[model samples]
Target: MPPVAFLHTHILVVVLFLVFFAIKAVLLLLNKRDTLDRMRSKTKIVDIVLGILILITGGYLLFLYSGRIPTYLIVKIVFVLLAIPLGIIGIKKESKGLTVLSLLIFLYVYGVAETNSLAMNKEEPSVAPITNTTTELPVKKAPEEITPAEAAQEEILNAMGETLMANAKAIYTQVCATCHGEDGGKGLGGAALLTQSQLTLNDRINVIEKGRGLMPAFGSQLTPQEAEALAAYTITLNTTN
Candidate 1:
């Protein structure tokens, strides 16, 4: 299936699962034993099936983006692992609180994914020197002799660079993820596994700009700098593996 289409399928099943969870939670909370007794067998089986689909679809997408997981994603995965059992046990034991807590945790995961790309866009822009003159370079010094202020400055620069990389990843997610997969190894629709690709940087950039079979050109959609950043991030798909 096309990557976007597969993603849509994944999302659909997720929403369906949440709906089923809500229904079961309400039934348990309201003590609707009569209705539950009547539909219990079918609903239980249906819920199990839905849960399985959710896992399979999620796993497929994760496979597409194997490495280079963001910190927030790690958090979401942890919460999901916690939420599943909580939700199941809560419903079986008729514990409203646990069910509600599980719902909230899943909500957090959804929120993180929705806002991830937006958050990447908010990174601090690179700072440039005001004057570009032949300033005398500082002599090499021992690492232990570095001043506190210099160390702090280095930390800030490092943070900024990290933010830029995150942004680059976000860009790739938006434009290239569909074709390249999350880990850039999906080889979807016969595209090459980017992690295994041997194309040079210039060749990759040119292909992105000009267009190739089954893939549209992105030069008009993205600026040169943006494309360059995305290309750089794509390079990491291999390095990360």
Candidate 2:
């Protein structure tokens, strides 16, 4: 299966696991012992299956990272490992304290993964200046980092228009995440690692609008503005200068 299929399967399994756990936790907290027990008995096989699926799918997705894993992802994985056994034992023993604690940790891990931040905040725009060998230069800020005036100036410079900056994250998630992966380090299907990309902004835009090697040109699928937006978003994934 393709990496995107694995990504989708991982998400679906995780959602089901969270919802199932939440329901069981609520029933236990409300002292619905009979109902909880009956539900658990009926779904015993399902519970095992879901657990296995979570591990299988999650492990496959992690494998796509190819050693360029981010710090937040590592932390998320640690918490998930801690949460799973706690949840199982908590549910089995009817311990409210452990159950709640495990649930909280799972929720936290989900947030951290989605936001790509330990603090669960949206990542700040990657506007930090790149250090030059001989002289300091202002690195071009991401679309989200620019003021309205700066955006207008950018439009003049690139002629892609301000709409190119709007909803870039959403665009990247929908159109680029399959090959690039979430943080752009997946390198699946021969996709380049965006985090280590050294291409300038315009060059990146050209690649997105055109095509390089195994990657197909998205020009027909995306408007010029949308293509530019995706290019700008990919720049934020660059961690290496």
lDDT of each: 0.64, 0.72
Off by more than 4 A, model 2: 123-174, 177-199, 202-241
The TM-score values for the models, in the order shown, are 0.50, 0.61
State candidate 1's TM-score. Answer: 0.50
Model 1, total clashes:
3
RMSD to truth, every model: 12.5, 9.5
Q: In candidate 1, what are the lDDT values of residues 129-235, reduced to their tens digit? A: 11111112122568898767545533432333555657767777787777667776554433445655555456677778866644657889888866665655665
Model 1 Cα shift for residue 171 (angstroms): 17
Candidate 2 has its poorest 10 consecutive residues by lDDT at 129-138
Q: In lDDT terms, how accurate is model 2?
A: 0.72
